[model samples]
Target: MNPAPSHPYRAAALLAMLSQALFCFRLSMPTKLMFDEVHYVPAARHLIALSGPVNIEHPLLAKEIIAGGILLLGDNSLGWRFFSTLAGTATVLGVFAILWLMLGRVRPAVFGALFALFNGTVFIQARIAMLDGYMAAFTVLGIAALLWAMRAESSGTAWSRWVLGSVLLGLAVAAKWIAAPFVAYAAIAFVAVRLNDARREGRSIYAALNARPIGGIHRHWPGMAAIPAILVLGTVSIAAYFATFAPAFFYTVQPMTLAKLLPFQMQMYGQQTQVLPHHPYQSAWWTWPMMVRPIWYLYERVDGAQRGVLLVGNPAVLWGGLVAVAGCLYGWWRTRAPALLAAVGLWLGSYVIWAIIPKSLGFFYYYYLPSIFLCVALAVSLDHFARGTRWDTRFLLLVLALFALFYPVLSAMPLWGPNAFHFWTWFPSWV
Candidate 1:
């Protein structure tokens, strides 16, 4: 890994600004709720009116944020999507930060975040009033913070980073339960790393279990503080997750109380786990990585032209990323490189776990979190192959070209006619 530049934040800021510009462009073109937005935007409106509860199957933070956007911008397209746009940009920054911390290089970080920006899922999710975008943003930010905390040089800084990471992961769950797997991964990874370090330093099992922070300064030997670390992760994350329900207590009708919280949670769990009628776009978990099916958020004629929004990953990024992730897994086995291991762990946490989720109905968009990490794996693979060449730059340019090519279909850009979508739908499954 190369040393990061002293001014990495400047580059990260520029990338985020670019992402913001792209996400905000033609954002209001549809001027109407699309797909799941119809479900969520109304929930946000109800929150604004304190009109009891809506969309109770999910948590409240995401709707609260959407309500805040509506209050600030009024109930319009922009209002529904503005915070999602910001969350999307933050996810870009989070990807950049994760790569920078893992690879300790600016170039690969930029490439990784750019790949995420054009990955199709982020751009589409960011433009809608949905819960996944916020969940994804907080998920990546939490992972980045935890990664940094693992490398911290001081105990105080390490603890602070861990606490922040825990809080962010909690917020991610508060947005959507899909993020629950990531929260579990964070705690497990942290404890595993700490215990491994302790064993490597010749500590006994009892000592490892009893480890506690000594002074404010101890060369950041987190191995000596595994107990406190686990406690902080669990306590802080659970507290933060429950704190998001505070607004529920203020509702005028059937206001939530301490006694109702557990029942409300049970209701959410029951709703989430129940099987639903099959839909045309519902897909099996295994088919997601192959892009076998995509959800058509909008497809209609407007102003004598066909306009559509397709929630699909960029073929180049999603397909090529599979090979890249495989390479990362192989590279990690051989070299035990931290960056490669982190990439694979991210893929497993986000993608593989979905196979066991009790939810009977899944969609292509459910692969959003995995697609983000696929970009990271691709960046790592490209950087390894570059090895003093411009291969990474060339691949990035190719991704950018494809992003441009698909922008019309991804955005609600005017097309030639009803059959215009056929031009971009490469496979029957995609259609």
Candidate 2:
């Protein structure tokens, strides 16, 4: 039997490469600074100049990446944005790699890559100098490495995977403090390993735990071969992560926690915890599932007077993914794709953290981080359908094609008709 003729992954990769390059350079006119570019541009400059450590609430990894590009490209709009575009480009490949790793299928990987490329949030954030895209890139990389570790059958292979996973995971945290929750999942993996070992030894882990000496817990250690593998990998990765911050952190980020450092952390924590009254763009997490209020990051008049404007995510991609999340839930219920489950956990977990926050500072863009995983969830469902029906693939391809066509007009161009370009105010809260 012969396999059905399919598009070569190399061809798809080439197309993906071209699209990302075009996307990175397309809006080279550099219309105007959008949203947080105000804050991060200066931050990148300081980093490139190797000035004093910039005291910031967020993590330093994104700025470090931007600094690298600025050093090479020279400090300017494009120079600062260059790293973001590259990270965005890398994200397309990352999505493909992650899907392939989790599902062990090529078709899903292609669909995932295509969907990620056409996604409006991805497209916009990737073009600008911003931290969000870098955060997403590291996150996807971490997920891919973690999945690789889980699937490895040999100690050597597993150790390599774990080390890669740990390095990437640490990078993720270094990209954003929000990544702290992912540690929960990491701990789950360790506990899972211990449980498997105890089971193999015909002893309940709980029994060992309830026993007299905690030191004897190693007696039931599942797969002694695997533990060293994980520890070595984890240790080295952690070392690398700390090494990046060590210059500023050697005295600050000490092994023995200092009382003075606690106040700085306390102040940072306070900012995240503080809630403001009546933020126009603020909305509840419950509504995010429905895509009710999307943040408008940039809107401007072009052509010397009026006519051109730019909004956020393409409505088709944003709204379509919202509905598709339901499909993802159903698909997961039916098939239980572990990849889908993992994505849902990350996506929902990030959002849930914000929803529970007493602070009102979270905004529409706050949803941006979680949106990537939501798209993955949708992609997983689409992959399931693509395998079952030709119509589904064609339908989704059409939807994406239509989205790509309208995306520029909806996102970057001033197509709303004269001042109508700014008529994207479907929700006053989003204004």
Candidate 3:
């Protein structure tokens, strides 16, 4: 086989185009909203009409984007799903960029992104008009920008990347409160890295504060610069998040005002925090990594054909990714490789935190963000253990084959009958 391209952007663009074509293929097949689209699509319509809120439990930016799609495309199935397809495509690119920035290689980046594309969660979420697809896209893009800022060679370039990261993270939270943890992780990680650098250089706290630049930006107290920089960036993120509520201020009914912002936030919090009943497809945080249960978004007769959409991870990627993540953790312990550290950190921030959240119910689809990072870990592990060998090619082919095998259920493609799902479900829990 020919070698992967040396140019990162060239390789990333090709992968992105492929992902977009796959995500957009048969996107409007269901011809109607499925699952949570029942809630979000109507909210998008309400936003388009300047009508009152419909799904106030979440923030507004994602719905606003969907509304913009409807306005541009005349409120059809394609309109409801166009931006989602684009967000899903961006997510594919974001994964490529994150691995590229972290590992500084084209092969791992390409492998990681292809794994993510074949991973069922991103593909399924992209076809539906839901919040998680947009949220996951912004969260990964924010992480990629932050990784770029850390390695930037010039002060101006670093500052621009930092600001861009902050804005993207803020937009992520505006998409859904589930993204809030990632923003917090970004802030804490930035400060910790700067402080660790100071300690590593054997500089006194005082000298570290006064001698060096933060991300190459000159500061009077360079060590202490992270404090003020974080403060400013935090404010910027808050401003970006609140800006998404702009449409709320103009609602034809029950308009929101600046004075009411805090109270509105309280209301949103109350709505999100309410204890809910259990769902049949709900899986515990611990069960997620093992793919113990999968959510069936839709499974019914459509247009006189048996059709379904299952939000399950590609087993070849997800099941194998667990071993890859463990390998990454061991590699990080042995060598402290920055790429391994990043892959592990992304997984922890997105997945482990779910264990501590107070929500009474959780679904398998909530594993979406962490699954993306799992692919990253798999890429890092493969680069370390199997680079320049045929295993890399073989593993990718395996993932692709499994993706194709599961594609029928992952999309709403016609099946032999309701029992056709049994062909793919190897375990009872998956039902």
For residues 1-431, what per-residue lDDT tens digits would candidate 3 score against the true structure? 01223478788789878989998898888987789999988999999889887788899999999998899987888899999999998998999988887777888888999999999998999999999999999999998887777666566667678788889989999999888887778777766665655676655564444425434432222223566557756887788899999999899999989999889888888888799887788788899988899988999998568999999999978889888988989988998776787788888789988888777788888899999989998999999878888777899999999989999998899899879989888899988
Quick one: best lDDT, which candidate? Answer: 1
Candidate-wise lDDT, in order:
0.85, 0.62, 0.84
Question: What TM value does model 3 have?
Answer: 0.94
Q: Could you give candidate 1's per-residue lDDT for residues 13-56 as a string of tens digits?
A: 89988999999998886887889999999998888878697788
Q: For residue 295, what is the lDDT in candidate 3?
A: 88
On residues 202-269, what C-alpha lDDT tens digit does candidate 2 reach at each position? Answer: 66666433322234433222223444544654565556555455334433223223453446556657
Model 3 pairs whose backbones collide: 209-222, 209-223
Global fold similarity of model 2 (TM-score): 0.79
- Where model 2 places Cα greater than 4 Å from the true spot, the runs are 1-12, 53-55, 189-241, 246-264, 275-279, 302-311, 334-340, 409-411, 414-418, 422-431
Comparison by lDDT, 1 against 2, better one: 1
Clashing pairs in 1: none
Q: In model 1, where is the ten-residue run with the lowest total lDDT?
A: 213-222
Model 3 RMSD vs true structure? 3.3
